[model samples]
Target: MNGVVPHIVQYQGSKRNLAPQILQYMPRKFNRLIEPFAGMAAITIAVAKQNRAKKYIVNDLNEPLIRILNEAIETPDLLIDSYSKVWNEQFLYPEGSVAHFYKVREDFNKGNKCAANMLYLLARCVKGSVRYSSNGMFNQSPDKRRNGTSPKNVASNVSRISSFLKGHVEFMSKDYREVLQIAKPGDIIYMDPPYQGVCTKRDSRYFSGIVFSEFVEAIEKLNQKGIDYIISYDGSCGEKQYGTDLPEHLGLQKILLKAGFSSQSILLGKKELTYEALYISRNLQDSIHFQNTQLSIFDSL
Candidate 1:
């Protein structure tokens, strides 16, 4: 809603485009904002841009992903320089872009980990999406059409992102439950945990998967503690659904944000409309400040 907020990267399952609509549900200001699943921390960036929260906690299970995010925020110079090297190195390969991407993937999987490698991989991966093998390795294929974001643009983005959140935010590579346990009444937690169907069991986009029952229990505890939260859980694209619905016993108020066409579906030659559901905690929806969120959900679509 404000001029486009700077982001570290275009992340798969990141709520980047949907963030503005989501922000309409949040209070204009709060003590803190916590993202437990924090992939690319899109919501955190959005909230920071709006100056909605005094502090932020960006946590994720993927260490490499979190490492790149940290570098973007805390050490922009190093990230840009190293990523530039990683970007330019691809052209030096005898086999061209495809070979370089796999080599980087090989090196990363073999323990040569760094923020630069992770950023380059995320940028060049197909559909900006990530895929991991059951053995916990980076296996996503390169896009092959593009090399990735240039160093100049990356520097600009890192600078802007750092300006918004550098001192105000803390990074964590902890379990979401640990973060949930630390949040207090005055703070707001915006959770975008991996959707169930694809991001659960053996098919996980993350290094780890959340047990649905445990996740539900965690939210239930938050309700008991009087903490306000907004959850981006499950939704459908035309007739194709993504994950299971939250329990009705939790007493959440569901609002559907029409998120337009799914890029993945479009890639598959299906132009399907996608609607992502936002599950608001009971007290949050009842607050006078947040009551109109449902009515304004479509405004940004």
Candidate 2:
């Protein structure tokens, strides 16, 4: 909690800041941690840093993102070298960082979704958020705040990420349900699915959308199987709420966590902290609360 865990890259909607609070509800150990919407594998990275899970499954609908995470975790030196080469080339263009950023974005969209090129686009994109056009192209503009992350900094973090998750992770680029279907008793899943309504939009941040009814059905199935899971689906900032709460009959215990401030609030001319909804499976929630109570009692003794 004193310092941040090393993430492979900065991503929009990443739960990096909220990870500490989320971790509080997690058991001290689990056989596996599965993330079906693992953008940059944020929670998995955080959990790995704490050595909470023995095995990990990181899956996403975005192929390039999964590729980047795979490259970062499996071969840090190679990833570092490729990323450095790509980042340095931005300065080589006379038109400067903005021009170079667009060029990288172009290559990424042109089926050159190699980890390095795709990663550069994400690092340089506006607000570090991912946007795609209807036909599945990288559509975000450059964030002229400067060049993307420095190669030196990226290299350091990549190395640390590799060390954190090298042997324990299995990366997948597939429909999330496939990953969820394979889950067994010893697995605890952490999901951060794209927001409901916006996912279907062509230019929305998520590459793909799951129908609301479909998603709820999937959750119900997981519940029926007694799977331990936590979801970060809906949240609020200031007076604006993002999405509807999960249905109560699902038997989840909902907890609100003060995540980082919402950047959208800044656009609305108000600075407000965002509170994310964490819906935990009832069994896991009860177990966590009981363990916490016993710990408090022990501390007071």
Candidate 3:
């Protein structure tokens, strides 16, 4: 491990905290690392710190988000400058901050595509949730919390993320199935698709509907081709289960990791612990060995 963990942009349903544990099951060496549904790319950025792959590909159905990531990778300095200017000039007015935020959102909706605008919205929006209206406009309201990350912090974060993505990473805006189809035998694909039964309304604005049956079929194809893969999805959040159940016949090895209360749970006034499911392909199961099975917290399914 390089011991350098880059800070990822704030995003909803981010697996930032679980990234280290997720990395444990990855192949020691691979020709490429592929992430479909790369929300803020928390896992991808974390894995890049380890430099385990010769190349990396991050794809998301959210076109604007992917554009921002590509811009960060290619011209971080410019993005930093633009974001800094907006922060210093617009965010200074505490009273007008909310109105200014909406103005920026309106501009963004009017086809002014830029990383700075997207970053600002993500930072200031409610709980880092990205949602759009039926008319294809950014619809999430401004977070009442302090004006988003400061210029210095955002610039530093962009620089760090850019440095990590300097040469090996390629960002793409495509369907998860299309991106996964390119994975060869030596490549490892990490999938964090929108959870079934969750985000039904929010997901429709960004991409086509995700049918769980079709998603499972894609992974089965990868299994047939001998490609290694891992997936993150809903398990149990406290007493309530938020994700759809996996089919028993898929034969996936399930490992559960403790997670914090989700944003939705917090809103519902529920303060219970959550768990994330890590479904591993059978072929890659032996790659990760649990030496102290008795002491480990992971549960096998």
Candidate 4:
């Protein structure tokens, strides 16, 4: 778990906390692991750390994030240099200093993956969120206390990842459905798409507000192909049906996972909200069957 720290630094919607549990359910053996919404690459990184999957294909529609990850994977030295320079200037600017933030963002947005990784650490929210404006720009304002902490050494982080990630990591910005083309049988796909039930303060729509029906259609395609995949979505409303009667009409099973807190309440506003992480799969019945049988055994015992 020590190696899990640096990997956690890069992700905005990281599943690091849930990784151990998720890993428990993963197949005992697999050829490759696919994460289409590789926000922080948390799950994939953990899988890589365990040497569970040889090849990893991680994709996201977020271009800057992808570029940042590529550099973190390919070149560490350059990223370290750039990040060091930025780390020195932390909190020197005023609050609401979008100008300074823009300069920082520009430097991070450069093609260097290492630099991008560093910027991701330096600029992300107090909680490592990458929520942006509706136009898809990084809108996370600067936090005053973001300083004082030891900035992560990109080189060291890269070295850790280099062992398992070099030449094996594939990064891209594309539609999540595109993952289907690259996946083959025996490939385990763990998708963490933008949750339909929640939105950041920025009011930004992630993943184009992925339509429930379209997502179902894509899952159906994966089902027909016998692809092994797990999808994570919103389920906070106690299995509240989504997008017309499709969930019941089409039989999309909802598995509720308590996501973090709501950003609304005054005093506890920043406190984590108990959201849900719904899991949908191609073989919905088999997945449900596994859940039911497991529950039955637990109940009987």
Candidate 5:
């Protein structure tokens, strides 16, 4: 295994730790690996590195995330330059430097190749949390730490990944469900969508109930078409809290997984805690198939 690990931002329900486990349940071979709600894309990157699929499609509704991936994959040189600029101006900026931060965020939002540079800066900000304004602008305050990591000159590795993605990978910023029309049978789709939880006032504008419903619909369609897929989300509550009302309608099996990491939150004088990762699958047949494969492999040894 290549010991190259990219330091990426960890979102609330990131699947960085859950990928290995969930991957074991999917079809062993497929045409492409698709991630609609690719946040930090922990699973997407893991799957790509595993090199099991012929094609890779990583997408997200967040423009900044997409921009970062695009810059890393398509233009490593520009990404390096952008990171250098942020490092050079690191000390000149002040805490909550609205002007400087806004300019960086604006460039990213405007599809600047340098957007990836701003992502690192913003992630290192106040909470390791990305908070944006109502108009879709990053408003997070900067952290005092400077000379943040640049992942060395792994441009060759980045280029290798980009080379594999020239025409193999597709990036999109639309609602994931809408962009799922291209999914077909024998494809492995990994969806890491926003969990059913609260968002701070800063980044609250981006969440959508409608998008969630449509995502369920897309999963159902994929399942019906015999497309192989695995979905990971937050499962802090019991099985009943799997939002039974949602996936049950699709005849999916809600699998509670102790995935990723969790943190406590106290709000409104009440403490409600939950796990960071949760998953739901197609049905009994999929589970049986997975079990049979595992048993067969064990027996072979």
Candidate 6:
């Protein structure tokens, strides 16, 4: 392992906290690492710290987010400078930080499309959410915290991510299906798509529409092609058992991950324990054995 995982932008539904546990389930050896629904690319970033794969490919339907990630990897100095300017100014008037956040968000919506602006919005926006309006404009409000993330921390993270991504990373702004189509036999694809029962209609506007049946069909295709994959989706949040039901005949193994209390739940005045299910493909299952009781996958239920 590479000691510590590099930090990336904040994202709603990000698997940042669960990444270490998720990594334990991955195959020890793989030709490439691919993420189809790369929100914040949390898994990829965490995996890259260990230099797990020879090559890395990540894709997201959100173009602006992808652009920022690409910029972070390819041009760290510039991204750092841009973010520093915004953070320095905003941190001064913590009480009036909302005005500064809106200005940066406005620039991002007007097609300025830079990593600094995107980072600013992600750090300042409520719940680290990348929500959009029907007209396709950034609409998330300020978080109202003391201030956004510090410039020094952002710069350090940017530098670390850039160093980690040096020559083996490929960022794509495309539909998940398009990226999934490129996966071959020796590759391991980790998917963290939007939660089915959790993400409401308004929240769904942040990315492209996900037709549940079509998504299952895509997984079926990956299975037929002998691709190894680990999929993370909703299991239970608080008292609610939320998630999509998979076809029993698919033969996928289920791993119930205890994800602790969710930040979203806390925001809503509820202290709900979040449980995520990791549905692992058969091909990759034999190679990994979980010694820790907490990380074991159940054979039934």
Please give the clash total of every predicted structure, in order.
0, 0, 0, 7, 2, 0
Higher-ranked by TM-score: 2 or 4: 2
Q: By lDDT, who's the top model here?
A: 1
Q: Give the higher-lDDT candidate: 2 or 6.
A: 2
lDDT of 2 by residue, 1-301 (tens): 2377887667888898878778887899999999999998889999999899999999998999988998899888888899999999988989888988888888777878999998888888887899888888888998888788888988888888888899899989889888999898768999998886565554467888877777888899988998899898887676677778889889987776776567877788887877777788886876777354221212322
Cα RMSD, model 3:
3.1
lDDT of 1 by residue, 126-223 (tens): 87787889898899999978888888888998888888888888889999999999999988999998778755486746678888989999999999
TM-score of each model, in listed order: 0.93, 0.92, 0.89, 0.75, 0.75, 0.89
Q: Could you tell which candidate, 3 or 4, scores higher by TM-score?
A: 3
> Looking at candidate 5, what is the lDDT of residue 145?
54
- Steric clash pairs (candidate 3): none
Per residue, candidate 6 scores C-alpha lDDT tens digits across 1-301 of 2466767666777888888889888866678999988877888888877778889998988877787788788888887788888777775755567787887788888998777788888887887887877778888889986566777877788788888776888889888889999999889999987777534454534566576777789989998998989999768776677766677666687777887878888999987776788888878875565444445334222
User: Could you give me the TM-score of model 3 versus the true structure?
Assistant: 0.89
lDDT of model 1, residue 240 = 74
lDDT of each: 0.85, 0.83, 0.77, 0.61, 0.58, 0.79
Where's the lowest-lDDT run of ten residues in candidate 3? 292-301
Predicted candidate 3 versus true structure: per-residue lDDT over 1-301, tens digit per residue: 2464656467877888778778888866678889988877888788777777888898987777887777777788787788777666565666588888888888899998677888888888887888877666788999977788787877777777777777888888888888988899888899888778644444533444477888888887888888889888777866677676677666677777777666677888987667888888877776655432421234432
Which pairs clash inside model 1?
none
* Model 2 per-residue lDDT at 240: 74
Q: How are the candidates ranked when ordered by lDDT, highest leading?
A: 1, 2, 6, 3, 4, 5
1 or 3: which has the higher TM-score? 1
lDDT of 5: 0.58
- Per-residue lDDT for 3 in model 4? 44
